[model samples]
Target: MKKDLRFLVVDDFSTMRRIVKNLLHDLGYANVQEADDGKTALPLLQAEPFDVLITDWNMPGMPGLDLLKAVRSDPKLAKMPVLMLTAEAKRDQIVEAAKAGVNGYVIKPFTAQVLAEKLEKILAPAA
Candidate 1:
């Protein structure tokens, strides 16, 4: 199931985008796209369907939280799952993301194992 899923990696930093993309690739999800910020991600997500969104909170154009809200509000995209991968680890921010419908939260400087675990939880139902 993971192999068939498509993903979008959104972050202002090219390095972070590459890191997430590579990690997704390593996990066998090769059909992934990159976006610089929430603004860019909004258009791409609307134009195409993505199984999951991995975004960074602090960005220049539109922030990740805004993106999550927009995605959830849009009828066409409301069902898409979002996972935040950012340095913003505050409880309030996490709670806000949860309210906005984020499926997972991963703090930055995280390990590959951590990312994998989150993905598994979102993509695979527990037995």
Candidate 2:
């Protein structure tokens, strides 16, 4: 993955967001923005250009799956890469996200290596 890729990390918990930010930084991806929930994230997505979206599956206003659906539905944002970084690990939920068009999915408690591999897998197609 390119280090310059702009990333939007959306999660309800500040700590989780921070952790993800730190991990991204460690991986040399510095151009990262954040939102606490999908509701907060949607406007940013519409307003700015992001190379990828990293979102949680559960949140107060609009969960990740719903946000993923919204992104897919929007004409401008339809092709944006989305990685579901969440704890929603049920097989059905994973299938749902895949059907909704998520580029990648990582369960919570993930390692940096795993995240890196997933990013590479998704970005490679476009690279």
Candidate 3:
């Protein structure tokens, strides 16, 4: 069921974005989109109906936390599941993301298996 769900992956680095996209592809999720930063992602989120969001915490213009807050505040996008994949492993950051309504958290550098597990856990009920 999750194989067809649209996913938006936001990150500052192109290499990281490609890596995540490839991992998603390996996990059987081919409908994935990429954004260089939260600012770029916001417009896409507002304009499209994405089932899931995978974002990095640190980004230029707007950070993932702010993006999560924005999504949560918008009635149209509030219910979409969000997974935060970032290098920020601090407890406070994780707590902040949780408070901001992120559905899952993954600390980098992560394995494809770990990413698959996180995606499965987040998308399981919907599937």
Candidate 4:
């Protein structure tokens, strides 16, 4: 995975976003943008090119699942990688995310190592 890839980290709580952003930074991904919710994230995604999206499942507005669906539905953004970094841990919700086209999923209260591994797995070129 490239260190310079652009990343968007979306979460309703500013603290979570900050934590994720800091983790990404520590992982050498400095080009990270933040949005408070999917409603805010979708517009930024539509406006610019983001290499990866790390989103929380619950939010005040459009949730991460809807954002993932919208991204998958958009011709321009369909292929962009999405990682659901959330607290939602139900098996059904994980399955739903897979069905909706999320490239990766990481439960909340995650470690920097876990985040790095998921990102690397998703961004790795297939052999």
Q: What are the lDDT figures for the candidates, one per model?
A: 0.91, 0.94, 0.93, 0.92
TM-score of each: 0.95, 0.96, 0.97, 0.96
Tens-digit lDDT track of model 2 for 6-124: 99999999999999999999989999999999999999999998999999999998999999999999999999999999999799999999999999999999999999899888899
Worst 10 residues of 3 by lDDT: 1-10
Off by over 4 Å in 2: none
| Cα-based lDDT at residue 39, candidate 4 | 98
User: Which 10-residue window in model 2 sums to the lowest lDDT?
Assistant: 118-127
lDDT string, candidate 1, 87-121, tens digits: 99789999988998999999989999999999888
- Global CA lDDT of candidate 4, please? 0.92
Q: List the pairs of residues colliding in candidate 3.
A: none
lDDT of 4 by residue, 3-27 (tens): 8899999999999999999988998
Off by over 4 Å in 4: none
Residue 11 lDDT, candidate 2, scale 0-100? 98
lDDT of 1 at 119: 87
- Please, what are the lDDT tens digits per residue for candidate 3 over residues 13-98? 99999999999888888999999999999999999989999999999999999999999999999999999999998898899889
Ranking by lDDT: 2, 3, 4, 1
TM-score of model 3 vs. true structure: 0.97
